[model samples]
Target chain A: ENRNNVDSNFKNYLINLKNLLFIYLYQFLISLKIVFSSFIHRLIALCHPEKSIKNQIVLITGSGGYLGRHLALEFAKRNAILVLWDVNEDANRQTVEQLKSQGFFKIYPFKVDLTDQKAIKSTAERIRLTLGHVSVVLMVAAASFKAKSILDTNFEQDIEMHFKISYLSQLWLIQEFLQPMINKNWGHFLTVSSNSALIDMPLISSYASFKLAQTKLIETLREELIFNGIDGVKTTIAYPSILKG
Target chain B: ENRNNVDSNFKNYLINLKNLLFIYLYQFLISLKIVFSSFIHRLIALCHPEKSIKNQIVLITGSGGYLGRHLALEFAKRNAILVLWDVNEDANRQTVEQLKSQGFFKIYPFKVDLTDQKAIKSTAERIRLTLGHVSVVLMVAAASFKAKSILDTNFEQDIEMHFKISYLSQLWLIQEFLQPMINKNWGHFLTVSSNSALIDMPLISSYASFKLAQTKLIETLREELIFNGIDGVKTTIAYPSILKG
Candidate 1:
């Protein structure tokens, strides 16, 4: 009886030890997952420069909101003459007006709905004629700030938010803008995404996933473009925090 | 006329080539800067894990807005418990209620004006007593998302925002929350910063400069904490993006 008791207790102790070890391993794994994902994202960018630069034109989607306005202001101030596309005609008009007023002479806002390919194409053609060449792109502005967590968020609107704002606009812009820029010897691209792309961002799953996709696209572009003897193009992704509300 | 024209053309061609070369080098430098900055951040975190861990406990000032809310949610889910310090009582009530509903069983909310450290301390001590072990922090929730760019931003508000939100809260939190965390063997901290901390992000100059200060402090904490033997601390920073509207 004593011998049997000893064996049974030993077995229970071993099992408990095993469970604790598993928890410790799980904790380390959680940390590693975060580190690994970040590393992979960066590694893809650095390792695959060619996949990034091929056939890209600079397209700024939201040339109207405060963020868009500031971006337009910066590009124009830097003497970059390109298409400033925005669905908001008044915001677009005001941006151009403000730029001109502020002595940013090179910028001209071209009102276009970024979501519509036809509109994007028409504007791209106009850009090809006027801007001499298109090479970089910046996508800013999106659906309203519904900062509710995933549980609180309405499912339909959540799905629509990322696609309508980032993915679709970026895809159309790349098809329209980047195709021409690749023919040129150079290009650079930037997507103004949210930092939610970094990790298990709550409430902003839609935004985070798309930003992650955008960041990945840049990495792929980097890889493809660099390998094809077209080493002149580059892409920079900007992830700003929630503007202090 | 032909000989002089040819000479002028040749001179212009050489100058343009030099300019192109210079531009290429500048781009290389910019890329290097970005990579270096990220690497440095990683190095600080890894080399000084203990410090980073201990410094994680922060007292968020505006801990009530959308950004603050989401970040608070992240901290509660991933890190240990949190002491939400916000001036708005209704918001705090809702935040606490939401956290409870979400099954984060360890969140405590305090409605206190941030401008006064004494008030902050009173609530903080209560948090410290209740938790018995409070380490790891996040100072999120600030106010700066007005529709004003650099040109239109009021200088006083810009300075006031930095002083009140980033710096003052940083100081107070160090006194209240961070001190306890540092005394303990572990901590992980973060500042809800903007990507302006990286590139010459135009428009949010004042805000960016202050955030840069936060980054520097974290770096210092890493160095100081690592020099000691405790390797259970970490300080992480996020350069956030503007999520949907």
Candidate 2:
């Protein structure tokens, strides 16, 4: 009876392994097909006329930062009305000045802190009243960097700060902007998450948690949009590695 | 000039596709080898003598709850010293009673609120004084359930509660218990995250975000342990789907 049981257990294990391999193989083939189809689509799209973003209201958070300023300039060049938000007043002004120097007159810069929910809501309200509805939102604000081990981290100061800036800010932004986009059936939501969110990295564990939370929030939002049958509103997440500028 | 540019683009696209396929195929083979090797290792491990947890101090949070109570019973049967924590006093008492009825005398139950970090630290101090050092911790405490969409959710109440229960509690538990284990070069930390952490689901977006955070925190801890060369300490994350019973 003992030998029979052992033989049966081994047989069951082999069967399970085979099943797992088959499933993985099926998924692999499907992914390959998707890649090939998307590649072909991109090639075909290159021959087609590019979609215009002219006259669209584009809101870029963390506009004073390196990447944010470049994104603002690109959108401004496309004739998109730019609403630039940054907590740094001087840095924001610098971006505005740079845009003005480049002859881009449709730039609106706001020195709004992303950490405060009430402040974000009020700023969003003011923007809606003055600038019409924002059609594109680029959430790029990052809180102050505190590289420390999880054991050495302070909960209220370090973790909470990252939580508010990386995750809650995105939540509030989506709440304010997503509904309007859903109503119009056309808008874009883009958030910059780090590759740390995908991989396990030491020293930045607290920050990575919030970044992962941010990515999950965006993903959930996308799923909700699809479930509600709203296709025009799109969400994009970029997982960039360490940036050097 | 346009035709030449198009021809060059097509050639470049094909070359990129080939490179991508090669990279993916290489990864596929590596993963297959890993799976096969791990399967063989597991089979060999089955033949080896099982490691005993006898006399090891095992701490389980949320011991009053369904899964928690059963886990406590199992650990008690293994002759491991049991330290159970739960916010519900009556439920915790019931778990203790169940253990006593089974003639298992090594049981300690604490009515500790996981949301309060101070409370957790104090309770942990008391446990250490009373029960020596905990070598294994199962963070199973779950905060109150609030099923609502992100739009209808309150940040201070629902989201914060889940954050405290699902993620913050794990962090605090690790903070209190991990170092002792690390000093001894032996310990196990286990956290229960939901399958919702992996897949996007509507309605429970807030809960899902924190669950993902909990999983990420565990994963980051594992990586940190590896980096610090703490091989004896182990971390685990469970992603269970909706439970029927």
Interface RMSD of each: 17.6, 13.2
The runs of at least 3 residues in candidate 1 whose Cα sits more than 4 Å from the true structure, single-residue gaps closed, are A1-59, A152-155, B1-245
lDDT of 2 by residue, B1-245 (tens): 99999998897677656655654575467566656765887799799786577999999999999889998999999999999999999999999999999999999888899989999999999988977899999988776566666667678877888878888888888989999888988999989887677656666777888999888888878766765657789887876566653
| Candidate 2 error regions (>4 Å) | A1-51, B1-50
What's model 1's TM-score? Answer: 0.40
Q: Model 1: per-residue lDDT, tens digit, B202-245?
A: 24544654565455445435433443333566666777656552
Compose the digit string of candidate 1's lDDT tens values, residues A112-190.
8765767777877877786657767777756565654332333256534554466555645655556555676666677
**Tens-place lDDT digits, model 2, residues A27-105:** 4675666567658877997997865779999999999988889889999889999999999989989999999999999
DockQ of 2: 0.22
* Chain A agreement with the truth for model 1, given as TM-score: 0.70
Looking at model 2 chain A, report the run of 10 residues with the lowest lDDT sum. A19-28
Candidate 2 CAPRI assessment class: incorrect
